[model samples]
Target chain A: MIDTAVLKQKLGDLDEDGVQALLDEFAAGTPSAEETQQVVEACQQGMEIVGENFEAGTYFVGDLMYAAQILTAALEQLKPLMSAGGGQAAKGTVVLGTVAGDIHDIGKNIFKALLEAAGFSVIDIGIDQAPSAFVETAKTNGAEIVALSGVLTLSIASMKETIEALAAAGLRDKVKVMIGGNAVSAETCEFIGADYWSKNAAAAVKQGLTYVS
Target chain B: MSEEKLKIREDLLAGRVPKRVFMQLRFTLEAACGLAGVDLVKAHFDPKTKLQAYRKVCETFYSDSFPIENVRWPEVYAPLGAKNWVMSSTGAMQHPEIESMLIEDYDEYIEDAFGTIMKKILPRIYPKLDPALPGAPLSFAKAYQRQQATGGEEVGAQIALSEEFDYAPGFFVGLFCEAPFDFLSDQLRGFRNITLDVRRIPEKVEAAVNASLPLMQRQAIPRNPIPGFTVFIPLHLAPYLRPADFERFYRPTFDKLIREINKAGMAAFLFAEEDWTRYADALAALPENQVIQFENGDVQKIKEVVGGKQIIGGFFDPLITLTRSKEACIDEVKRLLDIGMPGGKFFFAFNRHVLDIASIDVSKLVAVLDYVHEHAVY
Candidate 1:
């Protein structure tokens, strides 16, 4: 039997291989549910460490990438079991994508992970997606929240156009629209008639969840 | 030393640059380059061309001479497009059968899977195999030679020629530190996921960061010489991060990275791209002699935070030179100078890289510099 305390400490330490091994051990039916929750708590602690490092300027993009990798690994083990018991349905469904003419996916991907963890079912439309694609996907998925991300300053217009098209399609009011990315702000959100302007992925999910609820 | 070079360097050391010259130079460069002419690639071959052009434009407008420095000139190199894929380069995850073996818990397989796909497609889409390309083995040798020729003696010959020049110093050949969360949010995690991750699964986010620090630190070497000061680029952080959230998620990482870097005998330069006025005090509390360069941050607030202990750069908005009239450009520069120059330790320049635009007037920049140099106090 694996020690839940040890596993929790290892997860808090952000020990990828250790956590993975414990997860594997758990998959083999070694650890109890109580142990699994400990591992989850430890993982959360690890994120706080990451946040600290980031604020202090000790961490960078690559570190965040690796952290995400480790977290996803542990989550892989926990997500299914957590969902099985109707633990948390995503607060809402967000159909998110980087608008057309922009290939930057790092921001969009981060937002997706944050949103999913926040209990929102995120349908990522991928990068360089056309405006029509967003509207069509929102309609098809019946997604209550539509999130548009554009890093390129030039693509801000495309986001607006997408919003306009949604209105033209008579579906604008039906879905809550959120706009985010480096160039986006409260002013841009207002100018483009978006319901919310999220400065980061976390803020986006929070706002999306509220709107949906 | 030429007064121009000395003045600029002094300002940098003191944490501020005279405003008139800074504004004038910016306006002149903007006018001369136009939007399309600031070719980042060409600037690599001869950085002096851009510098000289700016100087010439300034001379034309204000009729002043700015001496060129013998300091190591800046260059640009190709990015190792595949370095990010080095871990997944083996295509181990791409095989559908192997991918299928991935248990539901290993969701990172999706990233591995996608990386495999992109690596396969890269060759077909951009099929140019130039040995001279950055990240190629030969490129390192070439960079070494260039460094040697330009009076760089310390480990200059060791630089890989193909390395891309992302910043002035480029990638340190030795040990370096980075904020882990920034790494994930800016370089790896698509923005959407990072934001969601921080709020929803803060634990997973923290764990991922911890696992990578040792790996990053392993890359750090003691012999690495950081010139000027350490620059913490908050480009991705500002638009996405809240002041309170920054205090929680980012401050600790920043503190650790700075402590380690400082212990290794280097200074920190916190470069905030967005309006960092809200978090200035938190940033100021880090270490002394640290430089804070703000892209769009308020100058007065930045000054108040650092309080003359550290250097501060950037108050002139790039948009002024890019879109506003030349007269407006001068006024803006003068405004920044009036406020920023009183305190020393200021290095002046546009908030960001000088973009090429056609309508910008170069002479205004020269005139501004001349006016500032003539009027600036010690």
Candidate 2:
């Protein structure tokens, strides 16, 4: 019904109008659930290219953010079409939050948008979230990956607490943990007991894809 | 003050090597409050108390001048119901990028950007600021006046201190200003909105950025240069842009704002607040006399790229100071001085902010500064 490869290229190209027009055109024909899933996977692949471009320094923080926005809106336009044929199944669930005592969210939001673009169903618990909140959400949602974000150095302490809570809840072994933000370092990551730490959102998304795949 | 201590500024401006490497540094509100053991909340409310604490902090550290203690009256914004510059967990006032206070559509803001700030956006950010809301016109005027009086009395005291205190290098007062990119995202569209708006409505975003610069500049830089004062701009959002986008959207206004300050014979000090390795050439492109404080970057690279045209500083890391052993911390200082000092234009300071006294080993911090004062000489 639509050239999924072309749509993916438009997404990687960050051609928002082109991506939207193509998605709208594809949806008008009422694609099948299986076919729509292919389109969605292609979009995710396009976002992978977007992430790659970001990693290559061709794109920037704004470009990654803008690409995610396009992916999000494009997904919404395709959602009903896939839902009518049968619901679009997310690759996996990822629980994300900025740990307690920090209110900064730009980094967290960027990570969330990119995670969503990579086709994971992300539950963003928002800023200043407690460890208990993370445990409860991960348990309830059966999240496979828990991503913690913060900007303040104080937030590393909270990230530690959140991970410990996950361990205490017996959910630690079940989920892969990623800690990120200005405050996070490999030293802090190892100390905090996170499985991985991302310096940028694109690398973080790449990690998310690795965990799910 | 001795001619030698103050001579550093003139030497730096004239592009000459001075007798000794100068020292200039800043601590965030939280760090200052925690270091002094002063009540953070009280410091936020009472300028006199904050200044006293600040003075003690400067003196205790044997600082050549006070840290940039430009609260510029944050409590004044509180009554206006400020969203960004509100109190934090430690009671220290900070402008965290929480929710951007501007919730209105871009078209209206795009149409007249500065006017939207005055008529619409400010009201949304500061809910208590309606002059026509009946009983009290902006209700905080009386309170603001009282606070100003208290602050004014302290500023008057600093003059007397300069005469008596040898450590006082006099105030290098700065009028705090925001770049249009910073204000547009921080105050209005925020990170997400502005991020998308660049792609979604490039024309509107450009219009808003272009229109807001003049208003931001007029309100920030002094027409006649104050003797020790400079225009301080903390570059926030520009680092996140790819150089092309930054040049298109931010470079012109940022360069112009600093150039005007320099043209008026006042040095404009800018805090290149994040990882700006990509923009080092762009940063070096600003007028050489104007000062630039880097929060993070290669000291050698900044010097090599800038070619000692400007006074270079701010590569000493607080993370190393607070967390590393005393020897390690001092080694980093020696490393910075080795790279930075040979030119005679280096300023000794921490690269990143030490947000509080929580992680600090005072002896280590003291040792680092003491070492700088001792070894970092021409």
lDDT for each residue of candidate 2 in B175-289, tens digit (9 for 90 to 100): 7677777767776777777777766677777777877788777867666656546677778888778677788777777777777666766666677777777788877787875
DockQ of 2: 0.41
Can you list the residue pairs that collide in candidate 2?
Answer: none
Worst 10 residues of 2 chain B by lDDT: B163-172
TM-score per model over all chains: 0.50, 0.89
Candidate 2 Cα outliers beyond 4 Å, as residue runs:
A85-92, A139-142, A161-175, A191-193, B1-4, B36-39, B46-62, B68-74, B96-114, B146-150, B153-172
lDDT tens per residue, model 1, A60-144 = 4434545566777778877655543434335678899987655666667767765655557889998777878998999998889
What interface RMSD do all candidates show, one decimal each? Answer: 12.3, 2.5
Docking class of 1: incorrect
Could you give me the TM-score of model 1 versus the true structure?
A: 0.50
Stretches off by above 4 angstroms in model 1 are A1-92, A101-107, A117-119, A150-158, A161-173, B1-34, B37-291, B296-301, B315-339, B354-378
Every model's TM-score on chain B: 0.61, 0.89
* Model 2 TM: 0.89
True contacts kept of 2: 0.40
